[model samples]
Structures are given as structure tokens and as C-alpha cells.
Target: MKTEDLITRLAAEAPATAPISGGRVVMAGLLAGLPALALLLGLLGVRPDFMAAMAVPVTTLKMVLPAAIALLAGGAALRLMRPEGRVGLAGPALAGLALVALALVVWRLVALSAPQIPVALMGRTAPQCLFLLLGLATGPFLAVFWGLRAGASTRPALTGGLAGLAAGGAAATLYALHCPEDDPLFFVFWYGGAILLSGLAGMVAGARGLRW
Candidate 1:
């Protein structure tokens, strides 16, 4: 085919432009996940002493940290939708959060006796917390994935990982409402593990699902 003819055909077959931006996709993911998350919350029920629990500074951190991560990581994920997008502040911000979490975990570890260390790490619901957070994050993660399909991300794995981080963070925020375990040892370890796993899952999904 002639060069001009080939160009014309390619342009005609090109995909439609995305309807929204990456940041919006992150928000939409949350919105899409809300109903299902709410239903799950209803089944689990919020902690009875929520009001009292919130009074504790550590308990408040449990909610705030995850929510902050969702917002920040979601922003980065959305930007990655564009071919020209870079990591920008997302890397540093995430590292900062990690350091903060690690410090908190260390502090908690110091406060606990040797016997308590094992018990603290293995909080009352060790298994439950990990699975519940991962399950809860799935809806939002999938939603974000669907939204990102409208985009043309060059770095699918990174984009998906960020989206997963956002989804997991949001789920953790909600889970904190029901989880009475306020200790950093438990929340940081279990919640972080769940979010990391979510990121890994996202990486795999992006590798397979985002291909044109």
C-alpha cells in the first residue's frame, strides 16, 4: 500500500479517545467499589466502640494513613495512563509512608515484651485481616483496571501496581473502621502485606490485560 493510504487506514482504525483523566479514573474506581464495600461492611459490622476507638491517636492513624496512601498512589496511577507520564513524587511519597510505618512498627515492638511481640504480630485476627483486606480491595482494583483500559499506558505494570495500591489503601481505610486492632504491629504488618499483594496482583493483571 502507498504510505498515505496506510496512514489513512491506521488513523481510521485507531481507538477512540479516553473520556476522562487518570485521577478521575481513581475516583471512579472508588465509587464503583463503594456499594460492594458497603455491603461487605454491613456484613462485618463496624466496631461497636468506634467512637471510643477514634479517640485513640493510633486508631486515627490507622484510618488516615491508608486513606492518604489511596489518594497519593491513585494520583500517580492515573498519571501513568499517559505514555509521557513519569513517576514524579509518587516514589518518594510512598517511601515516606513506608518509613513512617516502619518507625511506628519499631516503636510498638519496643513497647512490647518478647512474648507480647509474637502475640502483637499475630493479632487476634491475623488470617482474617489479611484475607478480608485483599478481598475488599478487589472491587476497587478491578474498577480501576477497567477505567485504565480507556488510557494508553506505556508502563502497564507500574500503572496497575499503583491502582492496586490505591484500591488496597482504600479498603484498608474502611477495614480499619471494623478492625479493633490499633497496634501498629498488626495494622502495619497485615495491612501493608495486603496492599503489597494487591500491587503484585495488579502488576500481573496489567501485564495481561492492558495489552492493545
Candidate 2:
């Protein structure tokens, strides 16, 4: 074939955009895995009583690290996944979902009715508020990253929800490993709270990021 014709054929077959880079996939996996790894490290050779009390805070910090990772990873995912442009309605829709999810988490927390209300609200210490704020900051970005991946795969809601559930479950499992308290109250209050927050953030991201 003539050179001109060969060039035309190649152009016609070229993808409209590049595929997700390998580095991004690796980064995402690492970010998602770090918390679990931290939990394992915390558990090794640790006493149960000390582990139980410290586990809550440690797990909370573990969760926070992933959110930071997600923020960077999500931005990269968004850039790669939507080379064409951002799907409309993703930002506003996600914001709305976030509002609803936050409300639900708050309601669940309130129902726990700890003997000392502030302690429950604030977790074991006042510093928990700072951790929660960190979650809030990075959670949305993580959601957006996962949401983009879901959108690329054409299963936005399902992917987003799964991401949320995974995050929740991971945190819960870590807490469970360390927690001495086996009562339903512990799960309902502490474990449940983490899951709910993560899930809500995931839903918001899915709602927003999935839009085309």
C-alpha cells in the first residue's frame, strides 16, 4: 500500500483516548491495600487489651491514609478515564449524595446513646474530630476516583457502592481485630459508623463521577 493510505488506516483505527496507564493501577492498588497492611502490623505480637483500645484510633488513622492516597489516585484516574471531558452532573449529584449520606451517619451515631454522649460523638477522644475531618476531606476524592473507574467500566453505581462497602468492611475488620468489645453495641456504634460514612461518600462519588 502507498504510505499515505497506510497512515490513514492507522489513524482510523486509533483509540479516541489512551488507556489507563499501568502506574495508575499500581498506585490505586497500593493506596487501597495500605490500611489492611497497617492493621496486620499493629496486630503482630500486640497484647489484646492494649490492641483493643488503641485499635480504634489506629484503624481510624489507617482509614485516613487511604483517603489521601485516593485523592492523588482519583485525580489521576479522572484525567486518564475521561480524556474527552468530565461527565456532566457528576459534581452536583455527588454533592447531594454526600449530604444525604452524612445525615444518615449522624442519625445512626445519635441512636447509639452512649452513657457519656460527647464521648460517643467524639469517639474515645476529642482528637477523633480531627480524624473525621480528614476522612471528610479525602473520602470525596476516593469516591471520585472509584467512580471514574466505574464509569469507564459502565457500572458506576455498583462499582461505587462496592468501593464504599470494601472501605467500610476493611475498617470494621481492623477495628474488630483489636476491639475486645463483642457486643452488638460496638458494631452498631463504632464499626457501623465507619461503614456508613464511607458508603455515603462512595455513593456521592458514583452519582457524580458516573455522569457522561
Among these predicted structures, which one has the highest lDDT? Answer: 1
Go through the candidates in order and give the clash count of each: 0, 1
* Cα lDDT, model 1, residue 85: 78
Q: What is the C-alpha RMSD of each candidate to the true structure, in Å?
A: 2.0, 10.3
State in Å the error of residue 80, model 1: 0.9
Summarize candidate 1's per-residue lDDT along 1-212 as a digit string, tens digits: 99999999999999986466766776778687888678767898899999998998877888888988888888888887777778798899899998999999989888999999989898899999998898889888888899888887898888888888889999999998899887889999999999889988888898878766
lDDT of 1 at 107: 96
Each candidate's TM vs. the true structure? 0.91, 0.43
Model 2 Cα lDDT, one tens digit per residue, 3-86: 999999999998887555535543564475565446444644233565455446533433343343334323333443544444
* Residue 46 lDDT, candidate 2, scale 0-100: 30
In candidate 2, which residue pairs clash?
90-208
